[model samples]
Target: MAARFSLTFDSVDAPVLGAFWKTALGYVDELPPAPSATRAEGLAQFDLPEDDLPEHGVWLCDPDGVGPHLSILNVPEPKTAKNRLHIDVRVPGHGSPDERWARIRAESDRLVRAGASIVDEVDGQHVVMADPEGNEFCVAATSA
Candidate 1:
């Protein structure tokens, strides 16, 4: 039998990262309940009820084109250090480092505007970025 799992990201801003993944993965947003306080409260935040939340949670597809899901979750604590494991995204084509860098930058800019942070730029072949939750992901030039 095949096993399945959901990858979770501890995010300071769950809705932002969730929106990003929703766009990148074609996944729909699970509607959450309104906060207990009335809209005038201005401090009451709301989210999906535990039972109403999707079983799959929030996730996106593997950047490699592999079908594994990448899930992001909201947590109380912030990420204090670099991730022990990371995701690498390969742009599906071949090119020189400069060429690759240009493409990667274009894509990275899009992601940045969408709430991801560019952590670093290395050569023209790769760039390291973090999602709104702070989980690291890299974009690399690829022949595939």
Candidate 2:
């Protein structure tokens, strides 16, 4: 069996980053465990110190339950360098290369409206983009 794990990102503003990712990935906030209505309430159940509680973090999960959960944690420092690891938003479509590339551009444009900025475009292959906080990711279609 394969082990499962979640992705964690350090951010100056966890909630903002989380919101952007939620929209970009079609994800929703991970609900707190049963009996706790809110995440804050859930944290309260743990009896952790106010300072220790990750009040600045946000948790998100795939709505279809396939992808790993994403955790954005607030940190003191700002992002200083390009990410060693990143995400790729795959856009699948049918028809000719032009059609597929058009779909990719449409998706990239939507992301730009949602606070992502286009960094580079590699012809019909992919579009490199950065999130609001400067984390890099790509939007591309699979090669056949």
Candidate 3:
């Protein structure tokens, strides 16, 4: 009962945000239960589609099983305001300030390419960004 619960996101198109976050956060889409597999086991396994197809509901899980799983739920309304609780993508700091900023910017660029838009950047501190759904999150540089 003490284990962390999955983070749920309310979205207009659940699968789109799910897929975006999957790539943005280096997560994988969770698969449904196999014919013979239990529910828990199914949640542990993921499917990689071999062909192009439109997805519906999407749930993302960390491949390393370190972070909480992210599930995007379809909602009728669109995002109108900022999120009260947001995730911070922490990139580990390695060397000097410039080096750390480089690392942070590199990650920021990658996420932007993956469908995130940069909201702003605070010098060498962090890069604030929003997901495809306009949900706000931060790419923070972690201390060494």
Candidate 4:
């Protein structure tokens, strides 16, 4: 079996940026690690602010325990260039092209409402978007 892995993002605010990602990716907040927990365990425990915003902490996990965990960390520099690697939000679709597009559009709209803006759209392919921090990602419908 493949080894477990996750994605890490550098950010100015881990909470705000991580929240956008959690909503965009349908992930849940990862619990803060135990005081005596190992380093890795502590990484899982992200301390969210009371309002869950304007706070300090990092980490989100797939509730179903299938998808990868996400780690957001603070950095001194800002994003000055396009991302060499970005996420693709994959939505499995079946049946006609219309059905596929409908599914993809629905997810795209959901992300927009969650503070993501569309960057580009490809016919029967994918919708590119940027998070509130200008981190680009794509939403796509799977081809059978």
Q: Highest TM-score, which number?
A: 2
Model 4 lDDT tens row, 1-144: 989998998887787888899888789977666673454455446674344332445778999999999988877689898999999998885878888888989999998998899999997678999988889999987658
**Model 3 Cα lDDT, one tens digit per residue, 1-144:** 676888999888787787789887889876554662543445335563433122435767899988998878776678898899999998975788898889889999999888899999998889999999999999977766
Worst 10 residues of 2 by lDDT: 46-55
Q: What would the per-residue lDDT of candidate 1 be over residues 60-106, giving only the tens digit for each residue?
A: 55455445565565665879998998767666666666677788887
* Model 3 C-alpha RMSD to native: 6.2
Candidate 3 backbone collisions, by pair:
none
The RMSD of every model to the true structure, in order and in angstroms, is: 7.7, 1.9, 6.2, 5.2
Candidate 3 local Cα displacement, residue 82, angstroms: 0.7
Which regions of candidate 1 deviate over 4 angstroms?
1-5, 24-66
Candidate numbers sorted by lDDT from highest down: 2, 4, 3, 1
Per-residue lDDT of model 2, residues 1-144, tens digit only: 999999999988888889899999999999987898988887787866567555699999999999999999887788999999999999976788898899899999999999999999997789999999999999998666
User: For this target, which candidate reaches the highest lDDT against the unseen true structure?
Assistant: 2
Models 1 onward score TM values of 0.64, 0.89, 0.80, 0.81
